[model samples]
Target: MVNKSRMNRVAAAMAVAALVSVALPGASAQAAATTPRIDLRVLVVDDGGSSVEAITAELRDTGVPYTRVQLGGSGRPVIDAAFLSDVVDGRPRAKYQGVVLPNENPFGEGSAEMAALVAYEAAYGIRQVDAYTWAHPGVGLEYTDSGGYSGQLDGTQAAVTAAGKAGPFGYLGGQVAFEDNSALVPESYGFMGRPRAGYTSYVDAPVGSGRASLVGEYTHDGRSELVVTFGYNQYQQQFRLLARGIVDWLTQGVHLGQSRSWFAVHVDDVFAPDARWNKELDCTPGDYACAGGEGKESTIRMSAADAQYAAQWQQAKDFKLDMLFNGGAGEEWKAENGGTDALTAQLVADRAKYRWLNHTYTHPFLGCIQDTTTVPWTCVKDASGAVTWMSRAEISAQIRDNVNWATSKGISVDRTELVTGEHSGLKTLPQQGQDNPNLAGALADNGVRWVGSDNSREPAQRPVGAAQTVPRHPMNVYYNTGTNAEMADEYNWLYTSRAQGGSGICEDNPATSTCLPAPLDTDTGYLEHIVPAEARTALRHVLANDPRPHYVHQSNLAEDRTLYPVLDRVLDTYRTLYAPNTPIVNQSMKEIGTELGRRAAWDKALAAGRVTAYRIGTAVTVKAPSGVLAPITAPNGTKKQLLLGTADFGTAYAGNRSAWTGPEPLQSSVTLRLPG
Candidate 1:
């Protein structure tokens, strides 16, 4: 009496229902049961090209963890399913959160390696960055020969698309101008092309009668690729300006490390007069090279009016200048001029408006006593043929006296911060190649935690007794120049060829200097040439996440207020390029020193393989050696998980939330929950 046909129909119906459960979105219960673990690391496939190297440099500089696979290296690991991913505790795990390829495909078409990478990316929902690629349909763009352009991109002005402004590159303002460092040399090259289907342009440049993509995202086969057309090196301004966007996009705005534009200016020799540059002699009059110029020496110092202008400038710009004051030199100037020193009085009255640091008492050389009889001075030595160094007591008095002077004037100064006269006492290469033996003790005596060093000389921070050295960059604006003409004259002397009516130092140092075809006219050079060049250099440093303060003499703030032009350019250009979300991080010397120290420790931990971070579903976990702060950048709304509950994570920066963090109390690792 059994209905076999009815039973068969019921079985078929059951099978159909099961298939529908797997096919419909949000109904695949088994597939939704577990989310794959995505390791917070990037995979970089290097073709040994500058484009790949540039992105790798950005990764390294930003402290993002990445594994590099050299295509040409014999020992390089193979790209395969096993290498790219694995099953961990019965759940799928992606080995990398993102991938950076030299181009759309370094591996030939139909190659198994390329297939493996594509499959892995698609399965993990990970993004890829084609660091540099030609415009072609393979990358979702039409060939440049078709309604596009192909050539040098130097001096080209590119704009971010609406998609870019709403996504990873939101930090950047619309325009991105390619660098034209040398008119004779093509600094940048690229192909711009019309986007094909599945392609969305992030950045584009004018081509023909329409705009074509320079950078764009291509989606196909369930994966995305950020395609870049231009060729650039790590040091190029164009690359730097776009580097952040590339990284953010590749990682989908979630990864380790954080970046910020940093800019700080230190005005040295405050309250003191700086020896003027003698254009006629092409040397500073008081300097040893100028033989009979001592009698004709003149000094440039800020008057009360200049001091007032400086305060007003700071207020207008909303930027603080670090004033490295020399009390004894101000007193000497006062005596030389009149009993009433208006500059000192004005600076004291508005002291709270600026940051004050010790620049020694009289700005005397604190290294070995210089034997200035020679053109390039040599260190004075005693009978034993050993260098006769400035004593520790003398160095201590210089530091102590300046701090006391600041205190007496009710000008707040950090006793722990000092910038030695000329960054001396550390080393003066070729003459005093070693630090004065007594300098370290003097720093300790004054409780100095940070002392300034010249970045041009010793760019890396190092220990000095119980303190550390905070290197400061010497700006191109000459310390001896107050007026624009003087600055231009000195710049021309240093940069022009001898045949061009100037010293040929640039020719002698071909590796470091670029000689001008002709001398810059003193009248128009400072405004038209020098300001932009100096501003560009300084902006490069800021974009590179450099926290080192740029140093210029107080003389640059006097007379013409020449420093303002360079500073203005830097500020204005930066504002024009970056959005308000990515403001310049201006920190005190102590704060910068601390940040550098933390980064060093974190980098060491990462290098030692002591740091482990991975994202599982909406949860991120990080473990590092105790006391080492791990830098983490995650999408906004991420929360740090505490023992009992969770707290909002990191401060917002550059469209994401990031911070240098360690684990909470009673925890050995950091855990964060990403927003749904």
Candidate 2:
């Protein structure tokens, strides 16, 4: 009983359904058929400018792999559609997730290369960063001449906007002050302009009577660009502060590298005394070069009151300091002072309050036997002309005895961690050109896995037997000084010219030193000038994602407690500039060493092209060498795939979650499900 009209309607409905499926596909089916594969790599087009170099440096330092195409350089890769993207296995594949250009238009306006870049960005939904550019309509901003301003940005205070706080720069608190290192030299320069339609400002500064954008996002033609109106080098404080946000925005919160601000302070000579700096002789009394100063030797050692104060300060700041201690030195001091050291007793009472690393039994020079007959001591050599190095037994005893002593006092310490006195047992530039022959053997004997080195001398981590060197930054608060006046006087002696009553060292080494305009007033200089300078330097390291611990001496914790002012300023400024989500990452010496080792391995894997990471839809796949961990940063809710179920991807940091991760059990690669 088929009705002809009904049969016709049913047939027509079927045909319409087929047509609709062909024209507008279902979400899952469409994604499966044509999902875009976006590579977790950045393409940097360099114009040989400081701004471009600055961003490039950030990418490199953060362990984010990138390809550089030098503009105006011979044999540079052409910016063509085929070069930017391709179809792989019937799906579109973008070679780079982000593109960093020297400016809004690096290949010139209306050029084929520029056109190709624009088309590629639009097609792949790739973000671009105008590393540095002048404000104009091209970047969706009014010209500086029109109700805007352009000039040096040094000493200017910029601020993150509401839009920024809600976007990639959510980690920052608000203010960003440009550094004015020298009044005679211009450090930063920029142009500020009013944002036009489709432009959202991230960071802005005062312009005329109102605010204008310094860094902002401009959306147009199915693509977006992060436009930066400022000029800066990689070392500039402003650049370091803003680099993480720039990279985050470029990658859209998903990348193959993770970054966190790390800060750790180590107080060396914890149980020993530091020699006093002689203002009259312009040298430390106990040092080799200070002649006729033996009888006048005075030492700066922490007292029981200072130890109590240190514990209180740590509780107040919620920070822990690493104690690089010498057990024999403390015992000797105790014997000299009626066999009762109040400082030692106080520190032992609060043993669990601070981290501890072995600084040897006695703070003896372990590199070589010194021939002290010469003014600048030389290494002693045997009859055969070979260097006379401290024996392995002696070195191992120094390391072993200290750990035993700490254990006896019920103080928890990692036996694998050691920081030799003066970073000895390693190479000393003018005297010992190489590590002591016995040093490696001694370190291996003691089961030392992490040994501290001087960052100023050996900045890079290297192996010594089974151990790796954990480079530490020497804070400007001198080991010899326990007072502010001594620090200032020494600073003036090193930085001022002979005409200004200094040693004239700054005049001789102009490349590495800056001569002060005038000698600092010993009474007021350390608080006014030195504290800010040292704090700024330390903050720069923290902002750079450097995990190296900064080392000051026990002397800094005694007497006037000179180190607290600088530390307070650094911590306060850091808190003011960053939100709680981006808390400073503090790690132990061994942890820092492990981190550096893992980073080195990861970097090696990336450089050898042994790692591949890409995102398809909300799924990220990262494949690396089996033993190597992959560094990943993604949205807060991202989850890592497991053999059976998913797990939280990484710990939260800088407004995202990140970790050095490896594949789950039975999995071939590390895979993550990104938040929608």
User: lDDT of each structure?
Assistant: 0.88, 0.90
lDDT of 2 by residue, 1-676 (tens): 3356446635643443344333322322433469789999999999999999988888888889899998988988887766877777777788999999999777753356766677667667889999999887768888887788899999999999999999988999898889998888988888999999999999998876899999999998768999999999988878887999999999999998888889999999998999999999899887777877879899999999999999999999888988989989999999998999999999999998999889999989999999877978999999999899999999999999999999999999898999999999999999889999899999999899999999999999999888899999999999899899999999999999999999999999999998999999999999999999999899989998899999999999999999999999888889998988899988999999999999999989989999999999999999999899988899999999999889998998889999999988888999999988
The 10-residue segment of model 2 with minimum total lDDT is: 19-28
Give the clashing pairs for model 2. Answer: none
Supply the TM-score for candidate 1.
0.94
Least accurate 10 contiguous residues by lDDT in model 1: 22-31
- The best candidate in terms of lDDT: 2
lDDT of 1 at 5: 43
Model 1 CA deviation exceeding 4 Å by range: 1-33
For model 1, residues 119-236, the per-residue Cα lDDT tens digits are 6776678899999998977789987778989998989999999998997789998888899878888788889999999999999988878999999999986789999999999988
Residue 244's lDDT in candidate 1 = 91
